[model samples]
Target: MKIYKILNNNAVVVKEHDEEKIVMGSGIAFQKKKNDIINRQKVEKIFVMNEGNEKFQELLKTLPEEHIQIAEDIITYAEGYLQVPLSNHIHISLTDHLSFAIERHQQGFQINNKLLTEIKALYKKEFEIGKWAVQYVAEKLKVQLPVDEAGHIALHIHTAKLGSGDIASTLQQTTIISEMIEIIHQELGMDLDEESISYQRLLTHLRFALTRIESNEPFQVMDPDMLEIIQTKYAKAYTIAVKVADYLEKEYDIQLPSSEMGYISLHIQRLIT
Candidate 1:
């Protein structure tokens, strides 16, 4: 595609099928001008400038070329390591975050990550990638970012992996899951073994349940007889599930249907028993 505008030596805005796209590569635009044809083989990343993503375009234009390169490199590594195609919005979100984070670090600002422990426990793979990302930035940019920054970066990666592009919703989901586990511990009066299989199962169930709740998707209808049997068999577990559900509703204004609660109760039963 021909260059519509040059972002830097490594990136340029190009038009294809009448849609604007930001294409990046090593020296892709060196000695090039507008209307120059891009070398397809040299192109490493292509971001479609879709509607409602004007900020992405502006960021591409305004952020330092090196910062954008770092974001692209991290995104490439994350996608390969996680084996998931992250939402393209990560290009905008991560680039913006990295630029701001580097600036903050340079200016003697320390942003504390309150959810560091929870993030490490809940998002193991993403957190691993986040750790790698901070190290990568350090080696390239000569900056010593705090470990808490990895937690913050992991949340961004998790949001992109969900393909939601809503970091607030992802953060809320993480907080809810962490708190829900605490509710189970309090209501059932047992300390959970975070490394145990049952605990992992419980965590996975909570994650999917929140996804369904947020998407307004109903859980599969449990038969009334089976539901009643399980509730009766695991009365305490079911009660804790309801309490967790209530917490979600009251604290975040997120309503969890009874069917989802029933599913959560089964997971809770596994943990308690």
Candidate 2:
């Protein structure tokens, strides 16, 4: 890799195998240089930058548009119903909330009413950004995201609502597990065997799953095909977790992706195993 243009000391424009790409860093890689060849191994962290290039721009442009619109909708909905902002109520930070909202739209789910009504009512500025975020995802990913999937996805993407202020590779899996635990805990009401090492291990795995999502790291649990393991070993937990997810979707007016939910349910099963 060669330094095409030193964007900053920590960052530079380097082509990957003769391909044009955008890169970012904390500082400029070169003081005054263009077309300075560099090694891929030498570069620290490189990312694909979206510069609104015509061809690629066409894809992501709509995403921001949709994001802003969605935010507006959320704001309006909240003001009309809950009279508060979802962020204020949940203490959900803004960055993660927007990220997850875009992702959920990418995966094809709709935002729901419960928090939607509140978000719109309180955080008008954040809601504006949220709407823009929806559009950004739409255009950037070239995925015409639906509005319904915006709210929960936004919540999941927002580290504020989930736990941290960032997303992990295991985010989808983490959301499922977190929601499952909340549901089951509500029902069982501290009945889980706290003294049992098995219970502790299960909680550990669940936490790990969430960390993965926040770090954008691959999920370690389902690295192998463990769905069967869940089904065979902890059938009750798996069944209960999934059922609770479905019930929440209906009762609370939130969207829960089944595939993501199942991943968490599988981890919950590990608790009993």
Q: Estimate each model's TM-score.
A: 0.79, 0.29
lDDT of candidate 1 over 206-241, digit per residue (tens): 888888776778788888898898789988888888
lDDT of each: 0.85, 0.48
RMSD of 2: 15.9
lDDT (10s digit) by residue, model 2, range 1-273: 666654334445566776666443333344547876554454433445344323322322333434333443443443344343343322122323554655765577664644443233222344454555556656655765555344444443343333434434334444455455567666544566644655555555555544554467764334335566665666676677667757656754544444445665755554544
**Model 1, runs deviating above 4 Å:** 16-18, 35-41, 52-54, 162-165, 185-191, 220-239, 253-273
- How many residue pairs collide in each prediction? 0, 70
Candidate 2: stretches off by over 4 Å: 15-17, 21-30, 35-172, 191-196, 200-273
